[model samples]
Target: MWYLNDDLVDSSYHAENENQVINHISVPNIQRSQHRANLECRARNTVLISPVSKTVSIELNLRPLSVSILQRHSQLSTHTQYEITCESWGSHPPPTLLWFLEGQELKGVTTEESRSSNTSVSRLLFTPTPEFDGKRLICRASNPLLPGTAIEDFWQLRVVYSPILSLRLGSSINPNAIKFQDDVYYECVIRANPPAVKLTWYHNGENLKHTPTSGIIMSNQSLALQKVTRASAGIYVCSATNNEGEGRSNPVELKVMYAPTCRNDLSSAEGTPVIIAASRSEDVNITCEMDALPESLRFHWAHTNTVGEAVDLEPEIYTSQGSKSFLFYNLRSEEDFGTLLCWAQNSIGTAERPCIYQIVPAVDISNYKQYPNYGIKHSFSSSPQFPRHG
Candidate 1:
């Protein structure tokens, strides 16, 4: 005779009514699962029932959420600790917040939520190094309602660091073979977080001024020599600087190419007919050099004996970087004693230098009294009588 939720109440759900046809059912809480429940009333006469009377529908909705990162500094110092905070605002079912660096998920995160606004904030602690400069970080918020889908925000990190520079000569000519009139170029390669603002060039510890019209093409990153000479050859240094700090590179040597020149000063002692005093069996090495340029050269050694006779003797000659060196090994004090002349010739021209080998014998001075006129007399009939530094 009575029904609760379209089910016949077996005298338990019966309520006191005047016609004894009313029943009641109590559900403590009606949730989404219990939505659209029907209730009816019927007169029990040979299994007779009435149509369902009432039904209800329940509607559920959640708030919208957004994820964002808090901007603290535009340029952060490298190798320094920083707190990156991400926030998810106003979400129902509590949107999950996560931190990502360049699409990679991060761990060890701490999250807190606002009780009234339903906003969750997550903080990630990080220390950025120089290798991590110019990278991007991200924060994401995902709802449980929408699985596998998330909203993300990103920030490109500009971590500041000192400049690292490497200066190198950009040229096709070999340094040892560089010749006069050959063009040369130099460039500075730099890497930094904020990047180097400027670069400077120096030659032999002196700053090189720009002389564009004078064939010296000097720029911030490049130093070009259109026409190289002996004055243009030196150690070139490059320096780079930024707001963070400055950096210096290893100096590069630029040698101008030309014909060979005798370096008699480095041979033995300095003189016009460069007088080289040496004892018998002493190592006598003569050398000459030009501003190293790429060119083949011929070396010839001629020795003028004490008898005023010139004979071409085989001298040990070593050539390198526009310079040539000759070594005299095991002189006999009498046979190797002579006026030595070295001639160097290239495609450009030829240059000559002279040397007088005074081979003194290692003998007892008291023996000179026993042997009168035992040594050859010093004479320069054709050469200069008075020696001067070359």
Candidate 2:
């Protein structure tokens, strides 16, 4: 007797000898249950001779596991539904479909069987979020035909979102006050899943023109302000836009700090010289003062004598606090004795004041008569002070 998977196989049972009988059946399919049957023979004489059936198992180790992504979700935008489809190719017994997210199996995905072909497609639908950006999605194909293994393919998601703009002050100017001619920088940083498409700048609600650099039109990121002036102060805003939408930053105030313009309304603008007589051929100090805003004023002196040509005088090597007029220390009768000109300057502008300067002649030494005494004291002085009678 023979059996195939516990079923009787008596058609090929025949007598091979007087006491031995054999059965042969060609296995058309070598399946897993092929070797699980028993082949046994029994003879009936005076008594029955029977043998126990032997168990066998067939191992058909043919692995046909292959999967691929036929079509995937094209809409890679955040807050939108995304869909993906994958198929199992050249697999026997129709491989099962599975889904994985971050190495973990996901449930609720169903496999679709093809009515015309032996193919099976697995589809997964999900709504993407910000956390799902750049996440990997997997489609797995597994079957009992492969025994204990599965094949999988993966896709990385690209989520697109609008740009969120943030404005910052770069290391060029402060918000309080900016100096004239100083460089200023305004940065418009964009935060988004996908990079921004364009950026724009506005001043006082008017769109500013785009600046070009290296053949590329630059808009966002950073803006350079060169040679800033008083007019550069204004309300500035930045806008950034992406495929999803646009974003803008709050307005920032840009104020420019500069010296005030030199004016002619000074109480001391009347060109009058403050004269110090130079006796004994020494130096003399003169004055021409002006009142100006932005008190960090600069002073310049110029003089022309009777013989020497007009020349610029070097300023004294010291700072004059709360006073605008500086002096020319050394003066000679033949060199620096004529009209002197003074100019006051600030960052805004410069103003000149002309004044008449004269050198008072020194008295002859013969006028100083010495008294007849042991110490030889002078009888006359240049500035005489009489004894106080009161």
Candidate 3:
């Protein structure tokens, strides 16, 4: 008869030319609770005399049944520290535990074992960075006696990070060659966790608003600039906001090119022609200034009578320097008393409108009252004539 843990073994065979019987016992689905169980073999004839028995204890080397992370956190923040624990059960001599992030081994992990409970626990101290978002964190348990048998549990990290933004020019537009009245646009690309909730645009350090009537249209991630002018050339920026924080992009400068135009600041009566009073046969120096890109400018002067007759003035009477032109004119007769126009040209094109000056006869100041020596008498000849120079 054979018994294991007080259970009889059903199969036995006699050894040839030996005074002994060999018994075979099969146990299925052994559990960790059954480790070190006693197994006994005994010999008896008809229940007579005491049975001769041999006993032994069962020993087993087992791989861990499962591995899991304990004290798990739902969220992790950048620049903050957090501690996590992992535990494994049902491994003989306690399983070796380790931590990993995105397939890379993690250091400074502390591991402890419980012989009574057949459990292994490991603790990991971690500090998350913005770049660590969405990475995989793993807890692995392996038995030293069992090679190639490792169990693991993993978590997808949900790290909270500030928004990332980039502002770019719209496709199909050349940044270096933007011209006046050209339609332009910009795009804002964003990368963030928890997604972006708001977006803003800026120009020249001032926040911009959506003003469609003024040709500035804006959306959550884009801006459309209709009919851009020289005023539109400036530094532009984009920003995005999320639950974590706000982030701003680097500045992008827009340069607009255009032809010559009259400088409004230097003009009197705005765009209307300026009136100059001068005497006949008097020499006058008229100056014309313009604003344009590429600075270099070519100027032309012309004269027109009230009857609409016009003639281009000779270039020898005018000298141009950069964006300004100086014209020396001799108003010798009534024919020179009409309108004088100045036009400028650059690489872009000719000026859309010329700077105009209306030449009229000066008010007569030929006679003045004289008092003692305190005031000096001033007078002009009835027929004033000044020498003319080519």
By summed lDDT, the worst window of 10 consecutive residues in model 3 runs over 368-377
lDDT of 1 by residue, 276-321 (tens): 4445555556554432244466666677766778877664343433
Question: So what's the TM-score on candidate 3?
Answer: 0.56
Q: How accurate is candidate 3 locally (lDDT)?
A: 0.81
Whole-model lDDT, model 1: 0.64
Candidate rank order under lDDT: 3, 1, 2
Q: Candidate 2 on 236-275: residue-level lDDT in tens?
A: 8888887788878878888775653323233223443333
Model 2 Cα displacement at 150 (Å)?
2.8
- The TM-score measured for candidate 2 stands at 0.37
Which candidate has the top score in lDDT? 3
TM-score sort, best first? 3, 1, 2
What is the lDDT of every predicted structure here? 0.64, 0.61, 0.81
Candidate with more favorable, higher TM-score: 1 or 3: 3
- Per-residue alpha-carbon lDDT of candidate 3 for residues 236-274, written as tens digits (9 for 90 to 100): 999988988899987899988889988743434345665
